[model samples]
Target chain A: MTDVASKEQKLSAEENISSKILTIYLIWSVIISVSIIIVGTILFIVTGKSGYNMENLNSLITAKGSLSTYPFYIQSIWSGVLTLKPFAIIQLGVLILLLTPFGRMLLQVFIFLYEKDTTFAIIALVVFAILLFSLYMVNILEALHIA
Target chain B: MIYIVIGYLMEILVASIAAGIIGALGGLGGGVLIVPFLTLYFHVPISLAIGASIVSVIATSSGSAAAYVRDKISNIRIGTFLVLFTTTGAILGAFIEHITPVKVLFFIFGIVLIISVIPMLKKIGEEVPNVERNDPLAEKLGLYGEYYDSVLKREVKYKVTGVKPGAAMMFMAGTISGLLGIGSGAFKVLAMDLAMRLPIKVSTTTSNFMIGVTAAASAGIYFFTGDVNPFIAAPVAIGVLLGAIIGTKILVRIRSSSVRKIFAVIILIVGLEMILRGAGVI
Candidate 1:
């Protein structure tokens, strides 16, 4: 009975710590995303159009476009970050939002390792790897010249 | 020109806010409403609409997940285990989206929405199931959790079962999410509520948590493809995030049965509309 009690205590303690961290991460991610989006929106309004053409919204739609050209945006993303364009800042916000879960998984990996929970650590690691692969699949494919 | 741009932004913002609220209340996530609205009303291309919707899903999922976690309602373990399958499925689904026709995607979306409502309709007014038997899979994976229900004023403990089947269903859910650029919350809830026999609250919260990772998996592909328009996605993300925050607050106070019925009716309408659009009848 004592063993079960201690186990439950440990689990709750772990949950408490992780939940606190997750809450902070979630709040910060939202703030950062919203801030960037607001700044981007303001800049977009002032500039009348960011790098992309807004006058003719129809041309911007890529529904029937070739899939091979999809990675072209990544180049702009790099330049946008380097130059600090409002559009790129907005894109960066979206990227950050997408990466938030990935960040949580990374934190879980560390937490699990610190707790010496090998099973969960491995699981978290696998999740982290899959997310990394998905995020970088375009670069990988390009490196392999498969696309 | 400035007025025109502002007008467009306001429209996207309002629509996204509505989608976010409805999505959080329904546990379906924001993508379902945002995608249909952008495509049907604004004449936004399917790919861009989908890209924007996926981004909004991340926003809604993360914003609400924080509240759910703090409340101790979301099952982190189950969500983590399922991510392994859902993420893999999402990647495959993203590739498939590249070749799929827009009309076909709409048809599938409509079909999925309609089918998911059936389970919700059947379970209306039903009490949460009590699972007395222990499944070996759940035991091995440590897939059980306890949360205090403020509405009921008691602690609810739930043990998950049918791990294999739930995981399989999650893969399909992830596939749909990735292909359609929506949070496949309906199917995720189904897999947990039915296959795993979890409580509805646990199922919904866990599904919400899992959605961020699932959408993230496909979002990268969409981003690289230049399908994510900054102009549309930015406002949508901000609006949905705000709406999701409000929805989460309401979720904790509302009865689960009412939420289910409302979710069913909303999905039923959206499903019919999508079908009509896809069939070129409207």
Candidate 2:
């Protein structure tokens, strides 16, 4: 009734700043997401044209056969025999960025009803970026046997 | 038939519904429900499933927290303070996960889940003091607020303290998140409700509000490390999100004490199973 409506209004007002930013971020994220799909498809097609066999490509993605290397902590049981595909790494990067700030923000605006402090919200976004970067680096290093 | 998309979407829808529902409940954190679904049902890789689960945890956190805030059930200032510690913990946990074995990581995670269920069964409807004297630290930290209680039919004011213990618990919660890829929902709620001793409602809302930021911090790393597969994550995230919303909506009406006990028992069984599997005993 009136109380519920008033409560909703008050809540929206409180979260106005964060909500606006979140909206902009969401739009940006969709663009990035579509781009990732396009790029992945193109990469897959071009790789196929270059005579990369679908069987090998699918296996690499499906984590069948020897996983080329331990990128993260757990390398799939398929490791020694199968040759590692280079495109998989780039695709993985694409997947990672797809879940980035823009992506996270897109989901957050739709999901959260609470108003977070703008400063804190911004900090959270930055921390998210850093965490992803670290993970990527860890995987890359592990793959290269650098670490 | 485009069955992959349909199957994927359907799976996500189910998980999201569950996460949403459980998240709305005061203490049944959404992460607990979502992770298992991803692992068992969809056959998602553990790392990717964990990544997706963490993201869904954030979604659940945001949805539930926002509702509670609108309802005037959460203490904002205190919640924010607790988030600072949990956020830091989440980052640390994500990095620590880089070094841990996946099987051992899951083993420990199941143990934590089992431990959390005990408290949820203890206090069903214990009313807390409305106006605790503001501790000096709480006063300085601005950890005081007022909320309207629906059951009591009045506005309730409270002062929050227990900074040291709250911070400690959040750190542990963060570690759990990093290691397990579960959202650490149960641990976060327990910390706020049991360790900080906030009202059940306040604890639940605040915990939900904070989880998204915490998960986001680590989920980024999860993605970059090639842990998030859209094919896998899409279904898992979507399912858990829908589930959590549904869970939250129905939470208040249900007799939660017995439900929580059952949930606890389920977690115990699952945890033991995972351990046995990991240990090669199963």
TM-score of each: 0.94, 0.70
Q: Write the per-residue lDDT of candidate 2 for residues B32-64, one digit (tens) a residue.
A: 656666565555556666766675565455445
Once superposed on the true structure, which residue ranges of model 2 sit more than 4 Å away at CA? Answer: A1-147, B1-16, B26-29, B129-131, B252-262
Candidate 1 per-residue C-alpha lDDT over B10-106 given as tens digits, one digit per residue, 9 for 90 to 100: 8889888888888898776789888889888888888888888999999899889888889898888899899899999998888778778889888
Please write out the lDDT profile of model 2 over residues A5-66, one tens digit for every residue: 89868865766554455445543443453344344334434444211222432232234112
Best by DockQ: 1
Interface RMSD of 1: 3.2
Off by over 4 Å in 1: A60-75, A81-84, A139-147
